[model samples]
Target: MANAQLKEEIIAYSKRIGIDKIGFAAADPFVSFKNRLLEQQQLGFESGFEKGSIEERTNPSTLLPEAKTIISIALAYPSKLKNAPKSKKGDRRGIFCRASWGEDYHHILRRKLQALEEFILTKVEDAKCLSMVDTGELSDRAVAERAGIGWSGKNCAIITPEFGSYVYLGEMITTISIPPDTPIEDQCGTCNKCVEACPTGALVQGGQLDSNKCIAFLTQTKDMLGERYRKKIGNRLYGCDTCQVVCPENKGKDFHHHPEMEPDPDIVKPQLIPLLTISNKEFKRKFGRISGSWRGKKPIQRNAIIALAHYKEKEALPTLFHLLESDPRPVIRGTAAWAIGEFTEKSCEEKLIQAKNREKDPNVLYEIDKALKNKEFDKIQG
Candidate 1:
């Protein structure tokens, strides 16, 4: 098959398989990506992942040595939650930001990409194909931009004119050569809404994204919160979407209701009390496949306590009380003490003092005292 014919066939099949958009890009390595990665490494922005991961990311040859073209695909996440559930009492505001409102995108994207890969091999018997959802050395966003599917916004997300930034990107690295599409011009012109709206200043001036301050990255970190970054966490329990939400391009993209991807009403905006009370077995059963599962139950539990503390709802006092004395994780216990201190009145102060005496962990005691000090409970008791 000719390159043009192959491109047309793949695009047709992609749309048939539920991808909203598909485009082709020449498998040229990203030229400036290496330098950016090096800069991030030196600045201590690279997380637990090794610095070598970045080099592998910039080298298309490492991903697919024989690749001549990249096939980029995007699926639009439902922008509106037509059946939006009520936020629990004392719940913090904010939706799941579409991309994460439903079943895991990785599972959905991979199954579809693998199907596309199978379809391609039937057309070109000897062709080699590799599929990746966000889990490859090659950058899906860069490939999508190069393929003219979208332009990279200052927030480092590829934004389609039709779907805005509410699309999930996937890619196929293949030996099959295809006619590459022309790149799109940057359409984000002079707009700084995404940058200015960032709660943690993660998106520093212009298009530079410092992952160190990124809420999305922080959400995926392990049990311990970094000292400097914890104060900026706000009430976010999972990924952050302030940039995408504030983008003018994403305006009016609300109320998407795809049945296949719809979030479980119970799971969407879950009650903090339930999270604090859930056992590890239940946690595995509930969140095993979601991106939030990467760090296991402990971090999610810890984050729930932090969010509860920030909410400062007196209603959450009972939940915090139960967690303070019995939670297995010391981090969760400490934060629960802090939450109790923040919300419970002097009426609850005696109970807190009793809990503080029984609390074996030093961190929990420290936070208890800190919370009491902040509330002037020490002066009252004195």
Candidate 2:
């Protein structure tokens, strides 16, 4: 069988299996990507959630020995939520980014990749194949860019002409050699909306990101969020979409091709207050299927507190106070203290003072003192 004929068959098969876009590329070491990773490391900009070493990340051969071709696939997701719930004054809602809207994309993409692998094995019985989604060592964007599936956007996302940047990427490396696709030319030309719109200046420059300052990364962390980023995070319980939302290429691009990728409005945009006391089992039952819940309930709970603060939802003060005094996790307790500070109610001060007296953790104590000082500052300003 000719490699070109196999490539065509793979593309046809991919479409039947729900893959929106498919491209092939030679499996060579991603040299430029490795250099960028080294620079990110030296600058302390990595998000710390990345798996594997830099060498393994940029070299496809390291993941699959004798890798000759890499096949990249893209599946577009819906940008706008249909019949979305409203966030009223007393009932504020937190959002998970569009990437986390439907089922966990990792599972969806892996399922498709596995089917492709099985199909490839049927064509060439001796063929070797390895597939990965977001968690894979190989960079999906790098592979996608090289494979001509999309141009790497200035926001550091693979932006396809059909789907814009609202696409989930996955790839598979195989021993079979296929004619590679031409790389897309960079189309971001002169636009800097994504960089300018970044709340914390996380998009340090076009095509480069400082993940430490990224709200998307910050929301996933288990520790107390930095004070400066709390308000910037707004109502996002998990992930951030400002960069993608503001991209010119992504304008008016929304797809509902796959039923599994359709978002449930209530799940992606749940009320902020109830999340404060949600049990682990309840959290799993509600959010376990989405990618945003990967970091667990603590980060989401903490972000929910910050969202309540961002809205200045006085109705949440009682819940915040309870968490401040009684939540076992320091991140939760500390974040609750910070949320309480946003309120000008007289009881907020009293609650902080009471928590300060009983709080044994230095981090929690520091947050309590900061809230107390902020309350004092508000009084002075008034």
Candidate 3:
């Protein structure tokens, strides 16, 4: 099959197989993309990519030695969450951003790409192909832009007309050449809503997102966080959607509803007390597929403590006290102490003093002292 005929058939196959948009580009060296990837590494903003991304992206031959074309595809997962709230209620946990609410896109999109690859191989007889969703060294946003699916928004997410920025992207690297699609123009001119809406200021300027300050990243980190960032995390137990929710482009748009994306009854609006008390066995059983469960129960448990402190949920006092004495992580203990201070009253002051006496960790001691002081201040006020 000639290259021109192959390219046309590939696009047709993509649309027929549930892909919303498809674009083709020669697998040239990603010079510009490499520079940005390196810059992210230098700035320490990259999560898991910095360690080896430079070598893989700088040499196109690394991802696929004989790669001649890159086909980028987009699939929209519209937010059709029934009974989705207008505003967060007390001690509530919101669902993952629309993109991740369903069965993992990696599984769904990979199957589609594999079928596409098989179709192409049957036609060309000797075509070689490789498919990547979010797990590859190739720059997905950069490829999608070049393939003309959508342009990067100020929030650093690809924005599509059909689904706004709530879409998943996947790519196929092939040895066959295809007609390149014209790249899309940047339409986010002077729009600052995404930046303005971010609760943590993750969006700096001109599509640069500092993942360090990103709520989504902070909530999911396996390491312990200080009381400072914990307070800002609010009630979000997993990934955040502040920027996407506030984008003007997403206004008046309806999300594609999927049954799998529906919020679990307990997770949708979790009670802090119940969350703080969940056993590890229960944690994995309930949240294994949810975004926050990937780090196990520690982060989510810690976030529950933080939310209890933020909301001053007095009902959670016994649970927080148990954690203060028995929780394994010092960070969790400290947040538990903070919650004790914020939620407990004169009735709990003696326990706080007792906790301070037995606590070994300095951070936990500091939190106990803070809680004691606040308890004293509350008595004076009353």
Candidate 4:
């Protein structure tokens, strides 16, 4: 069986199995990508969630011995929520990014890759294959770009012609040789919308990111969010979509090919206040399946507190006070204290002072002190 014929069979089979797009590339060291990653590391721009060392990430052969061809797959997810719920005055809602709207994409893309791996195995019994999704050692965007699946967008996403930048990417490194597809020409010529619109200026420039300043990365951390980014976070409970939302290439590019990728409006954009007191079991039952929940309920809850602060939803003050006084997690308590301070209520001073007295955690104490002395409140009242 010729490799070209097998590649054709694989493509046909991929369509049957719901892979939106597929492309092939020669497995080679990503020299340019390695240099960029080294720069990212030197500048402390990595998100810490990255899984592998530069050598392991840039060289596909290191992952799989004798790797010859790489197969990259893209699955398009819905960008627009159908019949989305509204975030009203007292019942404001926090949102998960489009990437986390539905079921976890890692599972969805991995399943597709597994099916492709099985199909490849059947064709060539001696063929060796290794598959991975977003968390893999190799960069999904780099592989997808090399495979002609998409051009690497300035937003650091693989922008496919068919689905724009709203596609989930995965890849398989194979021992068998296959004719590779032509790499897509860079189509994001002179358009700087994504970089310009990054809320935290996380996009340092086109095609470069400072992960420390990225809202998407900050929202997933377990500790207290920087005071500067709290208001910038807005109502995002998990992840950030500012760059993607602002991309010209992604204009009106919503796709809903897979039913599993469709978002539940309520789950993806739930009311913010209830999230403050949600139990771990309830959080798991409601959001456990989604990728945004990977860091667990702490970050989401912390972000929800910040969201309430952003809205200045005075109705949330009671809940915020309760969390400040009683929440076991320091991140939650500290964030809640900050949210309470946003109200600038004279009544909150005693509560903040009391919390300050009891708070053992230095971070929580600082937040309480900031809340107590809320200079904006004093300046306005004076």
Better of 1 and 3 by TM-score: 1
Candidate 4's C-alpha runs over 4 A off are: 379-381
**10 residues in a row with least lDDT, candidate 3:** 86-95
Kindly indicate the candidate among 3 and 4 with the higher TM-score: 4
lDDT of 2 by residue, 296-356 (tens): 9999999999999999999998889889988889989999988887888889989999999
Candidate 3 lDDT over residue span 20-52, tens digit each: 778887788878877877787788777662334
The local distance difference test score of model 4 is: 0.91
lDDT of 3 at 131: 88
Off by over 4 Å in 1: 49-52, 88-95, 226-234, 254-258, 360-362, 378-382
List per-prediction Cα lDDT, in the order shown.
0.75, 0.93, 0.75, 0.91
State model 1's lDDT: 0.75
Q: What stretches of model 2 exceed 4 Å from their correct place?
A: 375-382
Q: What value does the lDDT take at residue 70 in candidate 3?
A: 89
* Higher-TM-score candidate of 1 and 2: 2
lDDT of 4 by residue, 203-302 (tens): 9999999999999999999998998998899999888988999888888999989988888899999999899899889999999988999999999999
Candidate 1 structure quality by residue, lDDT tens digits, 1-382:
7878877888888878888888888887787767876776787766554323775677766777788888888888866655556655666432233566677888888988999999999999998888887867677788899999899999889989888998889999898888889888999999988889888888877677788678887776665565456656666668887888888898987534345676665564566767878887898787665565667777777777677666665677777788777877778777777666665377657767887788888877887777666646766666
Better of 2 and 4 by lDDT: 2
Clashing pairs in 3: 78-256
Residue 288 error for model 2, in Å?
0.5
